[model samples]
Target: MFDSRHIQTFAEVVRTGSYAATARDLGYTQPAISQQMKALERAAGTPLFVRAGRGLRLTDAGQVLARHATGILSTIATAHGQLKAITRLESGRVRVCAFPAANATLLPATVARVAAAHPGTRVELLEEEPPDSLRALREGRCDLALAFSTGHGGEATDADGDSDSDSEGGLIELPLLDDPLMVLLPAGHALAGSSRVELGELERERWIAGCRHCRGHFVAACAEAGFAPDIAFATDENLAVQELVAAGAGIALVPGMTLPLLRHTGLVARPLAPAVGRRVSAFVLEGHETAPVTALLLRTLSEAAADMERAASGSPRPEA
Candidate 1:
């Protein structure tokens, strides 16, 4: 089959007007140039040159190939340059889909870090919960996904029930943070003043649960503490949950990462005695983990998570 080497030789011959001159210009033996031209002619299924006095002249087919070769070579060169730029992290785009809580807290800081570190790079963000974001990643709709697990310690699945197992050539999950969970209590609650609250102590208090996954985690933690939570309300909205707690409707458990973004006027957040928490992670396709832009973003995400941990520790403790 015809290839770039043949096309380059043919173009050089057309430029120099003879095989001997083309060979001299390209640092090849004249016979080698002749052999390349013969192969190219065979692949083209036509004689591309004819004897004209002491020189060679192109046939119509030769002219056609000459005209198109320039464009093809230009396209190839452009592609090479762009790929090099991407490898250097000078220019590229990264699409990230994350859960709402992360979008509010971790994402902004991560995005800012990437922008400052690589001005030519760009990051696009989408807000979605775990399984859905995981689906987006598996579907190739996004380059990276930010998701969380309640320390369940198993393969996580998407909406279509596909597992993210690297052994199965699915995805790679990298842990970023151990976002601790805290108990949300009303201002006047008897246990609000405590530095930490044991799950067993809140056994009788009405609870406001979060998303389905969060509720399952909360329930499991409660079970481990030897009691069942009396879930009086259920909602995925962090602010709504805090509002309910403030109104004395019920108490709730929330991640520390989300606490800064949430209102705390009439509520108090106490560390859980048993230290229940979810693990936040970044997910990527198995082989794409080392792609330049994706890798840089992952590092920046880890840095941002560390920054969040420091901020959480240095800030005033959540009190009414």
Candidate 2:
């Protein structure tokens, strides 16, 4: 039979690199630590440790088992914390990333909910835009990523007019909502006088948008209006693009989800004349299903987006 004590001792020995060091730290004799390792190796039905460089090292199988065991330990630790939090109303931490503009709406509401539930769930929030957020997840820099996608950002496959949502590799993208791209007009630009602005009508107008990652969707949306946008400026910073528009520099496409955050009185947000918008989506690397909390966060985010849309459409949440 396997014991939690056996797992704990095996982890300690792997961490310390020597039976004697592990014994010293755990206050157990070297023989006891060795026996525990042997017991674990036998139960797992594979050799775990190998002698190397005057100390013990993990075999390939051992390293794989170690990683799984580490996660198992982490889950136990997290459950304990959550239980204590439920009792004392104190929680731990959840690391999340999002664009600066999204913080205005989603973050505030999400913070309110998590804060009320655990009262102690510390949220380590980071500011990152799409593709960057995707990269961060791939590099293990963050646990969950709040991002968006389009034809050109990352490896996206759109056949003719159909979406190959399941065709992508490297990242698993969960589309949350379709936030149409709204055209931001300069305070007193010619088209600003119109109740609605059409891209084809502004054949001579200039455009500002996010760099490569964001430019593709904005460019495609403008194309739907029957003209390529004149590239007067391009930037990844949302505020910078808005400020430039406010300065009468150029018109740009801003996602609907970020409308509330773009309170730049200097600019007016009008739906695209051709009707285009960004597809707001969440992203995570493949094979992360083992993380229960990560799944919970994804669920919470998806629910929030759905709630936002339901409120916008004046619909009620589905019956439980």
Task: TM-score for candidate 2, please give it.
Answer: 0.60
Can you give the lDDT of residue 123 in candidate 1? 91
Candidate 2 local lDDT, 1-320, one digit each (tens): 66778888888888889999999999999998889988888998999999998799899889988898887776566455434323321234456777765666676776766667656556667878665765555555555567655544342222111332334534566777777767788777766767667667766788887767567776666666678788989887778988999988888877777776776888887765656655666665455533555565667777788877776557998987
Reference-based TM-score of each model: 0.66, 0.60
lDDT of each: 0.82, 0.69
* Candidate 1, run of 10 with poorest lDDT: 153-162
Model 1, range 103-206, lDDT digits (tens) per residue?
99999998888888889788989988778887677656677888887755332334222344545536887778889999989989999999999989998999
Residue-pair clash count for candidate 2: 3
Worst 10 residues of 2 by lDDT: 155-164
Question: Candidate 2 overall Cα lDDT vs. reference?
Answer: 0.69
